[model samples]
Every structure is written in structure tokens, then in C-alpha cells.
Target chain A: MKPIELTEAQVKSRRSRNIAIALICVGLVVMFYLITIVKLGPSILNRAL
Target chain B: MSVINDHDPVTEIYISSAMPGDFFALLKPRVMSLVVFTALVGMMAAPGEIDPVLGVIAILCIAIGAGASGALNMWYDADIDAVMSRTKSRPIPSGAISKSEALGFGLILSAFSVAILGLAVNWFAAGLLAFTIFFYAVIYSMWLKRATPQNIVIGGAAGAFPPMIGWAVVTGGVSLESVILFAIIFIWTPPHFWALALFKSDDYKLAEIPMLPIVAGEASTKKQILAYSILLAPLGVAPWLLGFASIAYGVIATVFGAAFLWFAWRVYKMDEADRKMLPAKKMFGFSILYLFVLYAALLVESLLPKLLNLIGIA
Candidate 1:
């Protein structure tokens, strides 16, 4: 098997993605409890109609 | 204290093996049943028709999302789980699954549940499912949980989402009826959970979980439980008065609400040393029965009209 290596930047990037995922989960509960809607935004068809 | 001794020769490592227990635990099966039952009520009682297939898909996605949340909770709380006798046997704590593995599994399932619901059902329902998982795993886990005694008060939003998700699946939008359903759970959660917190005060304190009873003491917790119960009883009857449900539901709600208040009153009046485990213990046991019966009544009342219509008997 080949030795696996990741540069410092790559490791940092991976960790950043993990943090984003964690934050997204946290945001969900906060949004619900606050009753805030981060609208997915209106669709093009809905705008046209 | 370790649920699994890491250095023991017989100690197991769950490298990649899958067990039935892991999957069941992930589904948060007990929680899922309540979610499914409430979701069914929301869908059935909604004004318009959702195709049976779409409705089924929506509920399935919600169930999967709930499980994903459960898995993430187990992954993060593994250390605390090991210390709490009540949670020590969980898959993560018991060494049947590694924390990293559980986290990855949860992330994958959350993504899958959301994506499938979006594609097969609608973006609205899918979005709700995605949010529910995030709320339970992240907000309830990393944010409010350790940070505040009001953890469950805010975290109960996770439990409240199923009705909205169910409603969105059918209506593809939000409405008053679903909001009422949401409110019922929101109010119910504090009392229901605080009752447990009442008896599990030491466990919470030891785990540093910041449960209200642990931080505030029994009398204050009992008072809070009663206050929430007061809010809950009226809120429980709101669905019927607001026209989301019928008199049948209203009557049942009134009866259960009265009994719930009585139980909470019993809890509030008892002194800590005057009884067995404490007033909180009795309140805790009755509260579970109260929620189950209340939701079951909601399901029955919502379904009765349709069941009657189907047979041409109404």
C-alpha cells in the first residue's frame, strides 16, 4: 500500500469542511427554535407566474 | 469510567462492522414512532391531497433524518454516555461503534435523507428534514446542550419539527395547523423532559449536562414543570379550538390536560423528603403517559373523519 500524505493546507481545508457541517447542524436547531426561515428563495417559475 | 475497557484483551473495536443495534439506535426508533404518528396526523388532516407515494416518501425521509440526528448525538456524547448509567449501553459507549465511524454514518444518512426527499417529494419537505437533523445533532448537541440549563427548552425544537415536516410534505408550505402542532410539542417538551431531569438530577450533574433540575434544584424544577404544564394544557386544546381538529380531539385534550395539570400539581406540592424518590419522579412517569396519550388522541381524532369518509358512513 502506498503511504498516504496530505499537505498542511489540505488538512486545514478538510477540517474547515468538517466545521461547516457541524455548524449547519447547529444552525438547524437555532433556526427552528427562533422560527426563522432562511428561505431557499423563490424558484424561477414562481417568479414568472 | 469506561463502558468498554480499552486495554482489555477481550475489548472490541468496531472498525467497520455493522450491527442491527447500530441501525436501530440511529433511527431513534422510539422517537421515530412518535414522529411518524404525528407526521401521519399532519398529512392526513391537511387541506389538500398529497399523492400517497409522496406522503410515504416524505415520512420515510423524516424518519431517516431523525435517525441521522440520533447517530450524531451518540457519536458526540459517547464520553458522557459512558458515564451515565442510563446511556452507557449505547452503541458508541458500548464499543460496538467508533465515534468517528458513527459521525460519518450520520453525515452520509443526513445527506441521503435530505437529497432523496428533495428529489422524490419536494424541496420544502426535504429542507425541513435537513434542518431537523442539523437542529438535533448540532444545536442540541454542541450549542445549547452544555451551555445552558435551558438546553432541552431550546433543543425541543428538534422534536417539534416532525409535524412541520409532515405538514410541509403534504402542503408544500407552512400553515397555522402545523404551527399549532409545533407549539404543542414545544410546550410539552420542557415539562416532559424536566420531569426526567427531576429524577436524574445527579446523573446530569455528574455529566455536567446542565439539566434544569440539576442546576436549579427540585422545587424550582417542579415549579417550572407545573408552569409549563399550565401552558401545555391550553396549548393542547388549541388544535381543536383553532379548527385544525374537531370536538373529539378537544374533549380528549381537555381530559388529558386536566389530568396532566393534576399530576404536575401533585409534583409541585410534595416535599423532597416527604415521599419515596420525590414528587418529580411521579411527575416524570405520568408525563410520558401524558404525551403518548395526547398525541395518540391527536392521531385518532385527525384520522376519524377520514376513516368515516372512506366508508361513506359520515
Candidate 2:
């Protein structure tokens, strides 16, 4: 099968969108981790079976 | 080596050339900022302490939820937006983003914001945020906007929910104080939007939107604006009356509210031949300032003592 060619503008926009999504994902990860720590505090290490 | 079918229709594929800024524009950043400010005041006014990080998360979620609704509203209103001069340059109307993409973006963000708020904060606040999105996207944008002259009156509830949601973020419940905050914005909406509709009536008429000025004549719309301004004046001072804000805020609210009335009265007395609609325009500008100053005063009042004690200044 032949590949579908993308224009430079399209490729550039896609790259920027991907980078934005990646940054947002990283931010969300850090936020979730901080929230977990804030909510649980040192008790996060005291999980019961 | 197969025979070509000449009768088959050609299908077009869409590739997004939208930048991150376009997507951000879809969020309606100006409106989101107002939501953030009001919600922050609500959080500060509520009687409790919250972890700084969690408080930030709550505000972020509420802002995202508000933006999600804006995206959905733009998606649904793209047709009217394209016709209206004021909104013709919006992301969807400008062809920077497609309707389906906006819908997808709104839905995903709505779910994520609600889920994150519920997990990170209290469920009550998340529920309020979810209701706000639903009210704006479905109830206001889809149903009320094109249907009635009273649209902004009922639809204004969506905008007023942010403070209550903010109060819930810290307090885990609602109170008379939060409800008063909600009422101030709710009553303020009619006069604020009617002023814009007075000058922009031609836009609404062209777009076939049933704004007050387009549906009810300008004279009747002016009367309604005046009446709402009268109601809004005292409602703006309720935070002080309820003992939530100090006398300084009371004085500020009274002064701003009276100025709001003066502008509304000017709009009421404006001549039919006055093509400038200057009074209406001034009223719109002053109304925004009124809300911002009132909320900023409340926020400072709530935080000042704590801040002073923190620095040993009190």
C-alpha cells in the first residue's frame, strides 16, 4: 500500500498538538500525585491488608 | 486490475490545522477567568481551611468545566455565531476548528474535570460543576438561547454556579452566604446582558436570537433593565448584610450598585434617536466592573485577617 503524504503545515500542526497533549498529560500526572500525597499524607504508607 | 466505478462519490477527509491557541480560544478564556475569580472568592469566603494544592485543583477543575461548556456552546451555536458579527471570528465559525472536534473536546474535558474534582475534592462540588456544564451546554445554549426573550434570565444560573461550587469545594455544602453570592450574579445578569443587547440588537435580529431588545422593544427592554438594576443593587450588598463581609465592602457595594443604577437609568432615559447607545454601552462596562470589585472586596475581606496574622500585622 502507498503512504498518504502530509503537507508541511499539517505535519507542523500535528507535532504542536502532540506536544501540547504530552505537556498536559505530564501536568495531570504531577497534579494527581500531589493530590494523593496531600490527601493521604504520611498515612499513604500505612495501608492495611 | 478491477473495473473503476465512476458512479462512486468521492469522500473528503478532514485534517486539523488548529493550533493550541485555537483550542485555548475554544475555552473562552475571558469567561473562564471570571469563573476562576468568582470561584476563588467563594473558596476564600467559606469558613474553613483547605490544603493549598487541593484548593488549586478544585479551582482548575471548575475552570476546565466552565471552558468545556463554552466549547460545547460554540459547537452548537456555530451557525448563529457565523452569522453574528461579534462571534464570526470564533474558532469554529472561523473554520479553525470543526464542530465535531469541538464537541469531542468539550465532552472529554467535561468528564475529566468532573471526575478529577470528585476524586480530589468533595463530590458535592463536582456535582455542582457537572450541573453547571449541563445547564450551560444543554439548557442554555441548546434550548433557551434561540427560544425566548427571558433566556438570559434563566440561563444566567449557569454563570452564577461557579461561586457556589467554590464554596462547596471548601465547605462541602451550601449556605445562605453562598446562595447570596449566587443571587447577586443571577440578578445582575439581566441588566448586564440587556445593555449589550441594546446596542447589538441588530446582530441578534440578524442571527434570529430572541434577545430582550430584539423580542421586547427597546423601550420595554430598558424598563426591564432598570427594574433588574434596582433588584441587583440591594442583592449586591447582601454579603455585607449577612455579616460575611465588613462595613468597607458594604460601602463599596453600595457605591458601585448606585453607579450601576445611574447607568441603567441613563439607558432608560436614552432618546430613540440617539444612535450611539452610549448609556447602554457604559452600563455594560460598569456592570462587569461592579461584579469584579464586589468579589475582590469580599476576597480581600476574607483573607486580610489571616494574611495579617500570618505576617504579625493585625
Candidate 3:
């Protein structure tokens, strides 16, 4: 069995795409956090103990 | 990779060379910018208070939804796009991204945008956003584009939805004011696209798409452009007339709307033998400016009072 090999250009492009995906994932997490805070407001902290 | 058995010979291993920029291009950034601007105006003009954060989220979702539709359009229109010179360099047409990839991207974004908008803003706006994506992707790109010369006329509804969606984000329902905003864009689209069609009739002809100029001839297209411009002129000023916008906006809309009509009339009077198509070209340029100026005026009118109040000067 032989292992598949990627060209340098392919590797670079794949890396860049992975980084972009990572950044988007991070951004979405931040966005969801902000949305939760905005929607819940101070009342979120005032919930029953 | 495993060595192929003797029975099955190995062909070629597909390695994607597609960069992130190629995928970004699939979103049609120019169209997304217009969607963002119009939706922002809609949000601002609505008579309700919205948290700035929520408003930003709503705009982001709408823009993403619009981008998704653009990706779907690109995926479906790749073949014709390859034929048309203006669109030949698009990601799909240029082979930077595969059609299936584009379709998957569009579908994923569409779902995310609609769902997030629903959860964050309100269901009504989300529903409108979903319908807009469906209209652009399925109704316009797949059906109307190939089947009829009136594609842009009816399909313009998809573009007109953003402002209404924005308004919905604040009001949670449609109103006369929002409908007027929708009408302005709806009426403005035909003249804008037809002006481009007049200059690029050959491209539409080559792609076998039934644009008005390609199917109904330039004379009829010009008449239709002028007719739409006439309708749009009053409609652009309707917000002012209806008392939503101030007199300043009214005056701005009236002046810009008149200019739009003037450009359309110039296009209408352009001679068939005029090889330069200068009038049509200028109309196309002015049409974009006209819509932008009208929307920008509305946006400024909506935001200025708020800014003034914040500065303790209102």
C-alpha cells in the first residue's frame, strides 16, 4: 500500500482553508455568547438560585 | 493511497487547490453589500427601539442569507456564466470551486442564517429571509431566468425583501412603511438590470438567457425601463409623502428620482445605430447611484436624530 502525497500548493491552500474555518468557528462562538447575553440581559443573573 | 487491484486501475487523485478567497467570491460580495445597506436602512427606519447588538446581528444574518442565495445562483448558473464574458471569471465558472461545493455552502449558510435570525431576532424576519433565499435560488435562478424575459421583473422581489426583513426585525410585522421601502427597490430593479441588459444583450443572447433586450428587443426594453423609472420616481418619494421620512429626504428622493427618470429617458432616446451605447451605459451607472443615494438618504435621515441626541445637540 502507498500513502497519498499532496503538492506544496495543495498543502498551503488546505492550511489556509483550515485556518479560515477555525477563525469562523471562533467568531460564531463569540457571536452566540453575545446573543445569549443580549437576549437574557441582567435577568439571566437574577434567575432562581 | 492503497495500490489498486489489478482488476481496478487507478486513474487520477483529485486534490483541491481552491483557496478561501475563491469561496468568498462565491458569496457575491457586491450583492451582499447592497443587501446589508438596504436591510440596515429598513432596520433604522422602523419605528421601534432595537438594541444595537441585536440590530447588528440581524443585519449579519440577512447579509449571510443573501450571500447564500448568491452562491446558489452561481452554482446553478455556472454553465451560462461560462458563456457570458462578465461572469466567466466567477469561482464556479473559472473552476476554482465545484458546483457541488457551492451548493453545499449555500445550503449550509441558508439554514444557519435563517435559524440564527429566528432565534436572535424574531420568527417573522427569519421566515422572510428564508423565503428570499428560496426565491433567488429556486424561483429566479432556476426557473424564471431561463423560462421568461420577465425574470428580473418578478425575481426582483427577492432583492426587495431585505429591507422588509430589516423592518420586521424591529416591528416583528410588516407595515405600510416597510412595504413602501420594498416597493422602491422592487420598482428600481427592472430599470437597473435592463440598463445593463441593453449594453450586455449579446452576453445574454450568447448564454441563451431570455433578458428583455435579448428576447423582446432593445426598443421594448428601453420603453419598459422608462416605465419602471417613472413608477420608481414616485415610489422613491413615497416614504416622504407618507410622512415617514422628513422633507429633506423627500427633496432628496424627488431630485434623485427625477435624475433616474432623466437617465431612463436618455436611454429610451438612444439611437439604434449608436454603436457606443453611451446613453445605456450612463443610465446603468446612474441607476446604481440613484438607488444608493435614495437608500443612503433614508438611512441618514433615520440615524441623524439619534446621533444628534447622543451628542446632546438634538
Q: Considering every candidate listed, which one attains the maximal lDDT?
A: 2
Off by over 4 Å in 3: B1-13
Q: What is the TM-score of chain B alone in each candidate?
A: 0.91, 0.96, 0.97
lDDT for B129 in candidate 3 is 98
Model 2, span B1-314: residue lDDT tens: 12334454322456788889899999999999999999999999999999999999999999999999999999999999999999999999999999999999999999999999999999999999999999999999999999999999999999999999999999999999999999999999989999999999999999999998888899999999999999999999888888989999999999999999999999999999888999999999999999999999999999999899999998
In candidate 2 the C-alpha lDDT for residue B9 amounts to 30
> How much is B75 displaced in model 2, in angstroms?
0.6
Candidate 3: tens digits of C-alpha lDDT, residues B166-208:
9999999999999999999999899999989998988999999
DockQ scores of the candidates: 0.03, 0.48, 0.55
- TM-scores, all models, native as reference: 0.80, 0.96, 0.96
Off by over 4 Å in 2: B1-11
Residue B259, candidate 3: alpha-carbon lDDT? 92
Clashes per model (N, Cα, C within 3 A): 3, 0, 1
User: Listing every candidate in turn, what is its Cα RMSD in Å to the true structure after a full C-alpha superposition?
Assistant: 10.5, 2.7, 1.7
